[model samples]
Target: MKNRFRLNLFRFVLLLFVCVSCSQEYDKALEDALNLAGENRPELEKVLRHYHGDTLKLEAAKFLIRNMPGHYSFADTTEVKPYYDEVDSVLTTMKGCNVWTIRDSLVKIDNKYADLSPEWVEDIQIIKADFLIQNIDSAFVQWKKGAWARHLDFEQFCEYLLPYKAEELQPLDAWRTYLREFHPDHLDELRYCDQLKNSSLQSAITLNDNLWYYMRPEITEASQVRPIYRLSTRLRMPFGICADFTNMAISVFRSQGIPVALDFTPQWAFRSLGHTWNVVLVNNGKNVPFSGATSNPGQPHKPDERMAKVFRITYAVNPDLKRLSEIEAFVPSAFRYPFFKDVTEEYMDCEDVEIEVGDSLDGRYVYLTVFDNTEWKPVDFALIKGSKVVFRKVGMNSVYLPVCYEAGGQMKAIGHPFLHTYDKEVRPFIPDTSRRVTLRLLRKYPVLRHVQGVVMRLDSGEFHASNDARFREYEMLYRVTDCSVTGREVVLPDTLGAFRYWRYYQPKNGSYCNIADIRFYERATGKQCVGKIIGTDGCWEGNPGHTKDKAFDGDLLTFFDAPVSSGAWTGMDFGKPVDIGRFVFTGRGDGNSIDIGDWYELLYWKEGGWHSAGKRKAETVYLLYEDMPRGALYWLRDLSKGKEERIFSYEDGKQVWW
Candidate 1:
């Protein structure tokens, strides 16, 4: 027994010595890699410390170094040595300053090197190192101790750090700066975000805040569109549309080591436009969806309209989709995006489907589409094999149409639309060939994508006993810009409103409509209502100096605002009420076209009770209203939420809403 014990002790000591030697070797390798970062070596060491004693991270770091583009072999010091020297020089000058100033300096260097020999430029690894160094220093101010202290594998690092650069609207490194900007002095509220430590489901609550979601008006001409950047957006902070919110939250959470992705539909299946949002991939391998500019983080963002397909953005290139560029010219621009990863399966409740196409299509690519509000939008595509093509894992509970790209880029339907049931059954929209199924789908939801301003005239300086034209009681006009090529012509109900001069208004960003002209004519006599102009009056705040007079000053440049209340009114009194039958609004040609009225309600006061004379949907540049009770007390009120009534009237006749 004594001899056996001695042998066992010797074996144990040998094993311990071997383990210690291996650990020392690992530590030396880590140190050498840190040194390669040059002036940013200390920050690299700090980051790697999170992975101390973990072989996985050590292996990942080695892999990252080996796989980094333009990494030189040991013998090629001529290429690698100068690169590191340049990086060290740049970072040495950048130490001790805030991220913004350092970034500005780096931009100048990058521009200067743009013309320099490509050989002098550093490897992407060096650029990544510099970014990390600068971001880590800035993160310290926000986190105060451990900002990105969490240990993440190489994949996590790529997901969080790799693709972040200056985007079209956001300046480079703007996200790191945001950490300090969000809660500079009092970040404790954001620091103890233990709630964010949970799965993406719980972490989303941290991202959900009071941010408004508004789509900027679509400009028909592409040149007029402006890209909104993250720095400018952050300067305003948390008060942006969906894109702004997504960028901010993405930058903040990714810096803290959370896996995040931005996904969006090219266009809503039910609406006339598209939307983008953020989603968090939790540690549990499940995706928790959320939007940056919304109040709902506990649940997936479900638009009132149906989504055709959801495309996920990823930093890594997908080999399966790399060949897609050959089939469609737009594929590379869409699928080969550095940030695009098709995770359609995660959001779409889909199933495999085999569609019959009569003969062999061979090399042709088949596409599937669903009818959007305006036209059919192609959602997914598959390559044809035999006589038929198969779409794998597509969304169910939707009507899908098979289409093919013709000689031109135009899509031609190949098969009839069939409803793919949730239970995986595909049935023709009209299963019985003899029985005609008349399915008329009318647009019930009005597009509110571009309702930017309200047009209404306030009550004429009156505190009436009837409370008819009191504060917050007048009909306010809601303005909306039409996205279609042709402007909408709304046939207003006989009693459209009490306002005589109708004016068009747009948001401060200057997104206006193209209105042609305005004409007020009597339907009975077919005569124009333009005659002796009636004087106009409206409710004004503070002083009555800029009253309803500005609305009818024959200057589209000037506008009169009503008190910021729901029931404010504007009125016009013609010398007397003639046969003032109907009014026609004209579109403006000066590009001042801001004719957007989403909803208009004409209320007439009769026998001390407010009566709805007529209400019409206004989505076009020109609006026409017919049928009127001569000399009646009528007023146009805004039904849109949280809008004050402002009116503009034009008439030789009399009696605006009184």
Candidate 2:
């Protein structure tokens, strides 16, 4: 027995040593008896409230609650409840945009501050407890919510997904109800619109062929009649040749006192980025991409200078409709235009274009639209009772634009609000049943191949993020062939600026070469504008100037001398720094043309300060450059100051003579 006792004692000593050795690792534990013994510190109980479900955190919370000490109790001498009530009263005294009211219903079970004469000391304890309770409950409620909505970050970003949902009476769930509840005009459904309407999920497809489908008859009839006030407008960039030429021709014809509705084929080409043109409906018809309604044989209209560039064709939908793309020589398998990220200016929900009033909504989005050319007539809208015009928005949800209506031609729907209403139950659009069926089928069978996984590709396997279906819900013709996920995978050199490439040109032989990873692209601009330098050096063999200095023959890197502008601004100001830093010469020679000889002149206007920062004359500067020819390539170092002002050009005469 004595020997066994001695052995037990030895085992106890061994266990004690092992525990002492392990105490350092245990000290790092969040909160527990072991942690407290190791660190000799109080616990942060509130921190563990966020981790309520986890056993580790629960243990930490217990440690904190036990260790943290409280202040004096107030039950004997003074009433803590009355003070709490008084604080709640103060909260009700104020109200406004920047003001908030505090709730008056917290129960102080312990009269901790009753006898405390100085109210401030008692108030601190009460406030701290209140803060703790509020934070605990708030986290609990948020965590209970489902995974998608519970995520605060996603909730904050959700608005960007359904940007156009504020005023629209119906959201995704209420779309059918809204359509049935409200009156119906017509939804924009060309080839894919029908498919989209019946689809369980909201989505769309870009239909280039739809541009020529239903607008030919009307064009023939309208051409024979004398046209209205001939309207001239610019067809913006990224627009396809088919859309531009066909839509413009039809618009001119349709505006000749004939029936028409306006729609545009949306384009998001790698070459252009975001371009769209005319799509319309004529004579109470549905959405048309092209050729609709017949008035009579119209004279062949001249193409807009912009439309003159599209490849002409001879694919006519009707017997008499002879116009651009009527010959069908060129077939577009997939068209090129701008993408969503390419649009420079973003639009919003509100507009008062007809009244010359300019009020805008906070909701901003990039939309591609085609408007029918017609007189903006004033409608007798008895429904518009309120002084303020109310507008709503929808994407995948159905919305309608009107066609021909009411006696004696006095129509007014020039880009008016398009709305959708569903039955309290279900109402069918009989004429569009085929489209409806297709739309219903679409939701079940999503374009599986188009369910593209957005990835960050590198030398190794990629990490992918699902494309936000809600953000891009509209039926769009997306170019998925060259879709890339390689922006952040591999570290690329500065040569290509912002592109991904694998093969490049050999320095000596000018032959093509390859690397496992590279960054290179042919063009950078949204419009495929190949860069070009305007001015040239006296040597003329190569580029002789930088965008920075006056005396550079493509040798020195400095700064621009001054900001140059078209001299068009408010107050008739010339050389005002509104246009600052690097000068990018733009126009026909703006996209693809770039030259190395083009240089800039730097100047020092400040009289007193003498520093190296001041612009120096006759200093030759050369900067690293990679850009196309005939286009502009400039980066303004400073946008708002004159200290970095400079002129960009190649001719040496300006530096020597000026």
Candidate 3:
């Protein structure tokens, strides 16, 4: 009987647990699931039946594979991404089947409820490609039939695909010759380059059979001579605009005289969003964009202005990984990316400048910019003798390029306007067992009142951007830890007694946007204090698009600084040097009454509770208190156990009066 009673209690507890785990009662579970099944689901049985016949598929695959690479259909209208809507429709209908096929090739497809990459792709995007007649004779063209390829005739299709007409291809190369300003043919006003712009070296090189070809340029020289049109209200370059600007320029190029192509990339924006851009071969010259066609506020970029960098991309070496670092070169000229330092040749030490084999990157393409060695501008071509790549003879300011491994590690290069973009990426150097790292100031700091910069060396192990695998970008996340000699440490989360942390932005007169972020991490414990700036939805503050003194332009966020004192603990902060060489002032997003000039005292572990460590006396000043509890901004007033005046202060163990 007693055992039966115990079993009854166990069953009751089990039932209670199940009740807590779900929002709905168990009685309604079956009904809800049945309702979900009856929702809007398209009939897919017929679609499955269509593909069941094996003999029918083999015949189709043979024909599709034989003609898939060169098959294409162009749209009658000129809505830039002209194929998006139609492609989306095809994608939606195929949502019923998880697998789709064309001849011998089959792509694993998702349901219509998910996002999909554009279906019909014409990889030969350089120049202008329109399908007047459907033909199977090129690479990157999708195989299309039915009403798709019936629009344009073959002749008109070829003409539209050709981009520039015969009449508009004049007065080119002025930019190419200008890239090689010392070539004796350098025109006085604007620059020009004939061979590099119009002839063989143009990015529109041949690929596949005669009709199949692709160019890497999105903006070439001949196109820049014409008027440039833009529609962004703000002058800053944004992460979203990179690809749009590239494509827009390509469209404009084709309209005038030059032909262009888009370059796909997988790099993140300052806000950590993945992005892309375009590179054009206008006329015969290059047009590198500071900002793309779209508007990306909070980014330091200028789409209309010609960026100093005519071309920038990644490269490979011997198509292998053996001697990838063997090739070394840098910005051929000027203030390219901000805080930039083309450290390629800088880290050189004879043997290090050697490439063995097996190094490559997709972004590792080349650009042929105009050069003026005398004026210290651009050159069409630079030379390389064995391990040394030199600007020899009088040539255009351009050359075949290689990948950049700044700070002595491999990294994907992104846009920046400083001399340093070619060098290795820069980040904080962490210290192994790093007990006393120092905070050094930069050449110039932001003008905001409480803003500061910190360089932390991680302890527990030596810190080098080289060894750390997680160091993806050129910035570090950090949070000052308030721990002790074992027992228990006091942590100043993003919030500490109403004082929040702050972010430092770009210095005045910067040539490019300086986008770098420093965050705190506890190597010992993988707990992130969290994105204080990220929480407030703060903007990535810095110099954007060559414009100066603008803050919170990209995205808006809120950060806090150091403490704002306790009701009673000013004494603990003084005369205490217990070894805190590394510290961070965190910002919080919670609470109020956080007076503008209020300060906080440093606290450390003592006994069981936290006591003032950075103060002189125990009762006078409190090193730390409470701020933002959960997501709500709290105060030392909240940290206190009792009322405002006679509140709780950590004195002698228990919560007692000060």
Which candidate should be chosen as best, given TM-score against the real structure? 1
| Model 2: lDDT to the true structure | 0.22
TM-score of each: 0.48, 0.17, 0.24
TM-score of 3: 0.24
Q: Judging by TM-score, tell me the better candidate of 1 and 2.
A: 1
- Stretches of candidate 1 above 4 Å error? 1-55, 58-245, 282-286, 291-296, 299-302, 326-332, 345-354, 369-378, 392-402, 405-445, 449-524, 531-536, 539-658
Ranking by lDDT: 1, 3, 2
Encode model 1's per-residue lDDT on 250-342: one tens digit a residue: 765555444566788765654445677787665556666786545445464774445667777554434356456546544412333433555
List lDDT for all candidates, in order. Answer: 0.47, 0.22, 0.24
C-alpha lDDT of residue 442 in model 3: 12
- Go through the candidates in order and give the clash count of each: 43, 105, 132
- Tens digits of per-residue lDDT, candidate 2, 204-311, equal 111222223322211111122111111121111111233333434333322121122222223211111222332222222222233222111121222211110111
How much is 646 displaced in model 2, in angstroms?
30
Segments of candidate 3 deviating more than 4 angstroms = 1-241, 256-258, 261-658
Best prediction by lDDT: 1
